[model samples]
Target: MAQKNYSGVNISVDEEGYMTDSSQWTKEIAKEMAKEEGLNLTEEHIKLLEFIREKVLSGSALTIRAIGKSGFTDIKGFYQLFPGAPLKKATKYAGVSKPSTCV
Candidate 1:
């Protein structure tokens, strides 16, 4: 694990930069992470991130197909939102672990 500063808070993260403690997450931290990824998060993005966090916290498997069925956005839209690696990026920004489905 490593410590990263975001929104002036030092957060614990894995070697891959995924947050190690979801309770330490904040919207400001998410925005900072998104900005680092060249994204300017909008309300839709926040909503989708929230959905991802909720599902992960509930011990549900995260997958592109499940996200598509989430009504938050379809698979194509998810790809559009996170671009190159949707599930990886989304879970990272959502302050959750990388989904087992991601490379």
Candidate 2:
């Protein structure tokens, strides 16, 4: 799989299986990704991802657990947003860290 370079603020694929993108997985990108994932882009999805990213970026990485308290009613809300897009890869796309997978 191709990886993203996180050494800078731009999204880049690395020569090796490494990702170096910062992880900012904002609401906008997540919405687009969800749309591509066959999910309907709804306020619920946006709200969920935004909530997830906010919590995740402010401190520790967010596992599914952290998102439970957010007003989604189900994991479907998260999938509709993030959809297993890979936090590391999304972060890389956001230029936060190197990504080990593609989002």
Best by TM-score: 1
Candidate 1 lDDT over residue span 1-38, tens digit each: 78999999999999999999999988899999999979
TM-score of 2: 0.46
Best by lDDT: 1
Each model's lDDT: 0.92, 0.45
Name the 10 consecutive residues with the lowest summed lDDT in model 1.
94-103
Clash totals, every prediction: 0, 19
- Candidate 2's residue-wise lDDT over 1-103, tens digit each? 4533222323434553223342534445544444444655566555554554456456555555455555564555544445575444334233233422223
